[model samples]
Target: MNPLTVLRDSLYFFQRNLSQIVTLCLPLVIVEAILQRIVDDAVGPDASAGFGLIVGLLVYPLYTAALILFLDARSRGESPRNRELLAQAVNLWPRFALLSAISTLLIVLGLSMFFIPGIFLTVVLAFSEYRLVLRGEAPLAAMKSSFNLSRGHFWRIFVCILAVLGPLMLLKEFSYSLFSKDDNTLLSLVLDSANSFLQLFVSVVLFRLFMLISDKSDQ
Candidate 1:
């Protein structure tokens, strides 16, 4: 798959469905605002606020999957009512929570061995939600499948994620650096909310590309 093509299509999709996408992401924005506040409060000059940052990172994939599943339904001309899609997505919460816990443990263990294994496990598990929602697999099974599918494609996915997410992240950092003097707390929270929305858009785009590639390979 061509990266440029994927990026273009993803941008087009995001532009066309902006309103619907924003609607789907509203709840996540609220949650992220709360989380950002917690993180700001927890982190300090000398101490590392490790666990909270980790939790904050993991929240992205779970919610991204939920939002993408809803978008996918709408793209297929199915009923994509917020309530129905959210109910279906929420059903996977327990599974997401379990997978997050297991992945976190493995990552921590991997870090003990060295940093490479931890990074490897992270990229491998990156697409777990896509597998869960698209293939209708159980959570652990989805995690395993994502690991397998991502083996040769890990770097590709990593690059794709960065390509889509890096600029937005940089912008957030820049904004926080510039205007956060008066009250960095509120500014930081707003940045988090915007980042969450951008992430959802990127996730849906990447998930759609993955599904397209999977289908082509199957045929």
Candidate 2:
């Protein structure tokens, strides 16, 4: 549960497997960007926030599940084929999507209550994806397990998530801050796509944390 050790390993694995990570996630990110653009055109400038959120949710689970599986495979010294990994992800999609949608709504609701609650929920339920994808648990069951598993490991998970996502958020803000609202929509999507792709590193970091928690619990 050492945050520094987890961050160090996350960066090490992320750098060492950068190419493979790109191979697993980049195409999906591109497709998500394309779909978002198409939706933007169809819905026009006044689209509801919910519509955009749903659109992102639809594509998000695919790559996320694949990346999680990729990280797990890599941990076991298995070089899984991209197609094979995606096929399994597809099989897991129904549960993953449901879990994601539920998590997103709850987090949004939490955020609405106050920003701190949202961050709290995010840290508390961080392990649901691992439970659902790795253990094949039902979505609700995974959520329950995630909530339970995260207990006593709160600060460690928080730091692991923050170390990766905090900088990512700042980078996106700083990068986009240089641009204007009048900037080309394509430029906006490109910036977002880069940010989305980089966030997959957060998945790798969590996988490391999941491994640490599992090892500790076993001992």
**How high is the lDDT of residue 210 in model 1?**
74
Alpha-carbon lDDT of model 2: 0.88
Best by lDDT: 2
Q: Which stretches of candidate 1 lie over 4 Å from their true place?
A: 38-62, 104-115, 181-184
* lDDT per residue (tens digit) for residues 1-219 in model 2: 579988898899999999988988998898898788888789888878787788777888899999999989999999999999999999998889999999999999999996889999999889999999999899999999889889899988998898889999999999889986336877877887898999888888888998889788879
- Which whole-number lDDT from 0 to 100 does residue 131 have in model 2? 93
lDDT over C-alpha atoms for residue 75 of model 2: 94
* Alpha-carbon shift of residue 3 in model 2 (angstroms): 0.6
**lDDT at 96, model 2:** 94
TM-score of each: 0.81, 0.95
